[model samples]
Structure formats: structure tokens, C-alpha cells
Target: MIRPFAALLALAALFSAPVLAAPAADAAATPSWSIAIHGGAGTLQRKNMTAEEEKAYRAALAAALDAGAKVLAEGGEALDAVEAAIVLLEDDPRFNAGRGAVFTWEGTNELDASIMDGRTRAAGAVAGVTTVRNPIRLARSVMDDGRHVFLSGAGAERFASQRGLEPAGPEWFATERRRRQLETMKAERVGALDVEFKFGTVGAVARDQAGHLAAGTSTGGMTGKRWGRIGDAPVIGAGTWADDRSCAVSATGWGEFFIRAGVAQAICDRVRLAGEGVQQAADTVIGEVAAMGGDGGVIVVSAEGETVYSFNTAGMYRGRADSTGTREVAIFAGD
Candidate 1:
């Protein structure tokens, strides 16, 4: 009986001596970070996506994830990884951004992109720029260099050109599908994408090899947008925002309401001020955004390494890859 009592006391000492919460591991040491990207969010019809097209999309998404993962693996900062990953998508014609961006109403290509650094709260954006091939890179350059948070139109192009950035002609932005889409919109005579129609963009949120967090978004706006229409992509808090203290967010869908609601920043605020977990904050914000008549989705990653793909629409084109090499791609909310 004494022996048992002695053993119980030993166990009690082991259990009761206040175990500190695993000394909050160094952000660099814990393989507790991940990255996710989206091609866009819209009413994607499986019927419209042939197996070949779907396969191509999967490959493109995988390539983007790997590109970012490479940066992370090399101990690059999360912002660098996010930019690298998004550049791949921007270059890919499969997505409706960058090289294959949709056309503006006057039969021109206007591009917008924004980037945020969670650690510093520094951000950069460009709107209506027609020449810069990689808007995300240019945005990073703006953030790193000047005090300016945004640039627009020809001035933005000139700034990019001065930096020795490659300049592509307006024709380079044209894609047969987009041209046809423009025609379709003209026939329908609607503004932006009709509520009946849908579209998506490509984005990425990354934690680099050093465990720093960053997020980026790239889009061609909508297929037939008008009047200097800029979606969430160019709005710092609406389209993209990141902070090491909260999380990184990139949104897609009805850019108008998203802009009105400050979608991405709203989510971060909910988590930071309300103490909501990543998923809960994302769900609540997304729900509220949808209730406000906004339709679309968001890709969010929290500081504790949580990821959420939240949307009110039927589907969102999203992909995620983690330190464990676990990768997931989904269009539909289920399966």
C-alpha cells in the first residue's frame, strides 16, 4: 500500500507541476505553416471543364504550389513565396489573370494587383496598368521602395518600365476565350459579370522557409467589366491583406461589395479583436459578406498555421499544400 501511495505521489508530482504550453516553438522551427492558391471563383461548371482541361488546371495549380513551396523550402520569406507562387499563375494562360486577363469595355486590357506584408503592414497596388506583365512583382517593388501605397494607369506603367520590367503589348492580353466572353457580355448588355454568371481569380498565401506569412492576389477583373472597374485585387484590405499577428487573406468574387466591406481586413480584424479562430473568423466574415449581397470566396491562413477556404458561392477554385506535403485542390464545396 505504501509503495502504491509513493507511486501515486510521484505521478501527481509529474502531472501537477504545471506543464507550460510547449514553450511556444520558434516560428522558424515548427513546420506549422502552409500555402494555398486560387485560380478564381465563379460558377464553374463541371460540364464546361473537360477532363483534359481539368487535368491541365490541376497541373497548373500543382506547379504554382511547388513554385511557392520551393521558396519556402529555401527559407525564403513568406512574402517572397507568395509573390513567386502568384507569378506562376499570372504567367499561365489557364487563369483569367496576368497573361490571359480579360478585356475592358473599350476593348483594352486593364490589370490590377496588390500585395501585403504581414510583418510590416506595408502594401502596394496598381490599377488600370496595361503593360506590366507581372503586376504582383511590380506591387512588391512599390511596397519595398516608395512610401506610395497605390499607383494607376500610364503612370504605373511608366514606373514599372523604369524599373526595367518587361512591357507586353495590349495584344498580349487578348485570349480567344476572353474575346468570345466579351462578345457574350455585349450581347447580354450587362455590367461586370451578370449575377447569373461567374468568374474566378488566382491568389496565394504562403509561409516561407522562415515561417513568415504573406499573401497575394492576381486577377483580370471580370470577363466584361466596365468603367475602370477594379475588383478586390487592387484593394489592400478588400482583396488582399496580411499580418504576422493575425493571418493572410485573398478574396475573389463580387469585388464591389467586397470593397465596400473591406473583406480581407474584416476577417483579420475579427480574429485579432474578437479572438475567433481562423475557421470561425473566416466563416463569420464570409457569412456577413454574403449577407451583404456579396458572392465569392476567400483563401485565409492564420498565424497558428490554420487554413480556411470559405465561400458562399457554389464553388471556389482553391489549392493548398502544407509542410507535410499534403496537397488538396477543390472547385466544389464538397468532394
Candidate 2:
């Protein structure tokens, strides 16, 4: 029989004994994951939008973020989450992409899209495609099935059709608001400006539980664009690029500078080679490549579940949601 003092000592010892912590769970089992998205980049302002219009933009952004977060929570690949989020924006007319894309000089709508798988360095893109409803989906399909890296024009449309992608009439993409915007730009003689409106495209980058990275970009092409102009959207390194060892980047801005600098891939390369943080690498690229003579912004997601969004413009339509339920959305730089 233990004395009262002895019993008290045993209790103290038991309480003080190293509470054996459960074995640390696998990182994959408790993956550190995140999702980020952008509507586009440019001079977004409150004066340029009405209350209802702002609400629409917010709602659209929220919806996209929700979709992406859901995918990440389900152990989906980053590519799937990014694409799922972007498709919502692509299908919405509130932005200049997919179903609501801007018109070309010939009064026709042209679309561009790209997707990159960080794990494989595999990418696909479509340019000057007029009939496909969802160009990004078609791009992914190409990456998965076709041997080609890029497809353009009527040929791309044919390939999309062969792949069972839905085709729509040209009228299906037109919007009175967009037409007026084009007319206004033309009137101001600034239609040729280097994508200052920020109405470029939708992009997403994600890191998943499986330690994978992916990126995607979808655009209606440049506003009031001419001569079969293809922006960086379809140029893998320029507009969209990803690599698991580095980071995934999606760019929105002056297509010419983006293409010349390989904005997306350049950011990734900086991280892989220089060991820069996601924000540092992204800022360096944007300032060097995009802000040199061009104008625009980008969203980046690193392998460690870090996100960086930087732009020179007044604002960029952007949002982010992480595994910890941190959800935030913005339209302007200040937002």
C-alpha cells in the first residue's frame, strides 16, 4: 500500500512524464497547400465601375476562389484546381475571356489559352481560335492527347472539334459593353496602348497535397487587337509556366514585353537558380520585364505553399485561399 505522500509523488511523476506525442504525420497526409487566382491586371478604378458592376466582379472572384479551394481540399492536383477556378471566370462575361471575350479588328472574337503541368514540364496552348467555347480546356486536352505543343486558327478549332469541345456562334461571345469599350479606346486613339486597361485574362496557380504545381491562363486576347495578334496567353513561357522545382507563374500585361522576357518562366528560373523567395523573384521579373516598357502583373505559387502577386498597374483583379481558410479577394491594388 502506498502512503498518501507516495501516491501524490506518483501522480506528479505521471503528469510530468514526457507526454509522448503522436508520430508526426506524413507531409502528404497533412499537405500544406494553397490556391491563387487573378482576373487580369491594369488600371482598375472605382470610378470606372458602378456599384452593381463592382458587386458582380466580387461575386465572380469569390466563386472562382471557392471552386479552387474545394479542389485543393479534395486532394486534387494543382492543375485541376487552377483550371477549375479559371473556367468559371472564362465562362463569365464580367471579364474579357472566353464567352465574354473582346472583339478583334474584324469585329470577331478570338481567344487564347495555355496550361502547364509543373511535374512534367508539359504544356499546351491555342491561339486565334474563334469557335471553341472553352479554350483552356481544349489546351489541356491537347497537352494530354495531342503531340503538338501549340495549335492556332482554323486548325486549332478543327482539333478542338475533334476532341468534342463545344463550338459556338460568333455572336455568343459579343457584349454591348465590350463593343463600347473598344469604340471608346479607338476614339481615344489609345486602342494601341500596351494593355493598360487590365482587362486581359484569368489565371490561376496552385500547389496541392501531392507536392505538385500547375498553372493556367485564359484570355480573350488583347482589346481592339489587330493583324491576328496573339498575346502571351498562348506563349507558354510568357503568359503561363510552371515547374515543381521552382514555382508556377501566370502573367497578365503587355503581351510583347511578356513574350520577350518570358515573364512566367523567368520568374520560376530566378527561384530555382538564385534561391529567391517567391515574392522577390516575382517582383524582380515584373519590374524588369513588365514595367520596363510594358505594363502588367502576375500571380505566383511556390512549392512551399507560398503566394506572390505583384503588378505595376493601379490594381489587378486577384484573390487567394489557403488550407487554413484564409480567403481574400481584391480588384484594385489597394483592395
Candidate 3:
């Protein structure tokens, strides 16, 4: 039997013991699997959108989410999950990717895409390719081909043909909406295109049951872009990046600024080296881009299954899903 004072001291010691006072279970649990995606980021205001248009965009985003979520739910690889989702967006004429890519100064549609696999630290990209039906698929082919990390222009088209990838006719890519946008840009005759016209890149990031991470981005480049310009979408570490030890990221915004800031990789680096949470790292990176006068957004997923959608613009078409059957889609800033 201890004295009252001794008992009180013992209680304090027990409470202070490191083992008994061990930190609470990590709030950021390693999820079984998770995925996040973004369609584009820009001045997407409610006034500029009709109810029907908003509904269509939301439906498309949901479809993409379902495509990727299905793969993840079935225990597929993260790489496969990202590819599945992006392919859907690429085919949808509503987004500026494969089927609905923007036109170049030459009146041709040039698509760009990149993909990264964190488990193997492998990546592949294609830029200024006009004929690949789905540029994301070609990017994956390049990665699996194992001979090159990037391909561009006629070479990329030739490689895709050689690899038996489907070839898309120019008509298949040119939508009336994009053609009208090009006319508008030409009429403006301005060197700097508007952010609204430059939006509509599609991207996805995922973590699989095996704990591997992956990211992919696809875009039609900029409207009225010329001189064989290539944006960040096809540049590894700029528009897209992934690492099993850090996180995966996909960016959609002004390509030039994103390239300059290394937006995607910067977010992952903050998480990997600075010990920042996924949301915090993404917020910091997007803020840095905004400070540089760049408007865009990014989707990030940590190794522990944390997901973040960070943007500096008025809105970003985005969505998320997990193996637990939770799914959400939003386009406005607050939603």
C-alpha cells in the first residue's frame, strides 16, 4: 500500500511513460486503395455554365471516376487504373484530350500525354502527336516498350503505328466546339491566349492494393498554339510524377507556367523531403504557381492513401474514389 503522495507520483509516472503515452494511431491510415483525378482548371463560373452543361460535365467526371474505381476495386495495378480513367476522358468530346483536342495554328490537333509508374520509377511521354487515338495508351506503350522514355512528332506517330495502336483521322479529333474556339483565338490575334480557352487537360492518380502509385496526364495542348509548342502535359516531372516513397501527382493548367515551376514534382518533393501532408504539399505548390501568375490545379495521392485536389483557379473539374466504395465529383471551388 503506497502513501497518497506516492500513489499520485506513480500515476503521473505511468501516464508519462512513453509506451503508455505513445502517439495516437496515425490518422492517415494506409488505405487499401485510392484514386483522384482532374479534368481541367480555369475560370469556370456558374454564370458561364448552363444547367445542362454543368450536368454533362459532372456526368463525364463521374464516368471517368467509375472507370478507374472499377479497376482499383478489382485489385488492378495503379498504372492500369490511371490509364483506364484517362482513356475514358480522352475519348469524350467534352474534354480537351484525344477526341476533343484543341487545334494548333496549323489547324491540326496535336495531343500530348505522360504516365509514371512509382513501383518501377518508369515513365513515358508523347508530344505533338496528331494521329494516336488515345495518347495515354501510347504513353503506356512507350513505357512498356522499355526502349525509350519519350517520343514526339512524326516519330511518335510512326512508333504507334508500328506498335499496332489505332490511328485516328483528323476528322475524328476535330469537334465543332474546338474549331469554333480556334476561330475565336484567331480573331483575337493575341499572343497570350485566355485561360478559359487553355483549360481542359485530363489527368488521374492512384494507389493500388499493392501500395504502388501511378499518375498520368493527357491534353490537346493550347488552342492556336504554334511553332511546335509542347506543354507540361507530356513532360515527366512537370505535368506528372509518381513515387512509391512519396506521392503521385497530375497537373492541369497553363502548360508553360507548370513547366517552369515543375508543379507536379514539386508537390511530391514537398511530401517526400519536407514531411508535408499531401494536401499541404499540393496547396503550397499550387500557391507557388499562382504567385507566378499561373492558374491551374493538381490532383495528389500519398503513399498512405491520402488524396488532395488543390487549385488556384475559380474551379477544377475533379473527382475521387476509393476501394471502400466512396465516390465524389465536383467542379466548383467549394463543391
Best by TM-score: 3
Which candidate number has the best lDDT? 3
* C-alpha RMSD of each candidate structure in angstroms: 14.8, 17.5, 14.6
- Compared with the true structure, what per-residue lDDT tens digits does model 1 show for residues 1-335? 11343442232232121111111123343455588888886556677678898788878888898888777776678888889889999888778788888877678878888999888889988888888889898888888876798998988888898888888887777778777777766776654444224555778997665556788988888766678888888899999989888889998877877888898999899989899976777777766665665667788888866666777665567787767555777665553
**Model-by-model lDDT, in order?**
0.76, 0.81, 0.84
Stretches of candidate 2 off by over 4 Å are: 1-31, 192-196
Candidate 3: regions farther than 4 A off: 1-30, 191-198
Off by over 4 Å in 1: 1-30, 191-196
Per-residue alpha-carbon lDDT of candidate 3 for residues 1-335, written as tens digits (9 for 90 to 100): 21254442232232121111111134444569999988987767788899999999999999999999889888999999999999999999989999998888889999999999999889999999988999999999999998999999999999999999999899999999888877876776543245243377999999999999999999998888889999899999999999999999999987887899998899899988999988888877777766666667888889988777877766789898776555788887767
What TM-score does candidate 3 reach?
0.90
Ranking by lDDT: 3, 2, 1
Model 2 lDDT per residue over 159-209, tens place: 998999888888878888777767766666555332235657899999998
Model 1 / residue 332 / CA error / Å: 1.9
Error of 2 at 112 (Å): 0.4
Q: In candidate 2, residue 158 scores what lDDT?
A: 92
Write down the TM-score of every candidate: 0.88, 0.88, 0.90
Error of 1 at 200 (Å): 2.9
The residue-level lDDT of candidate 3 at 120 comes to: 81
| 1 versus 3: better TM-score goes to | 3
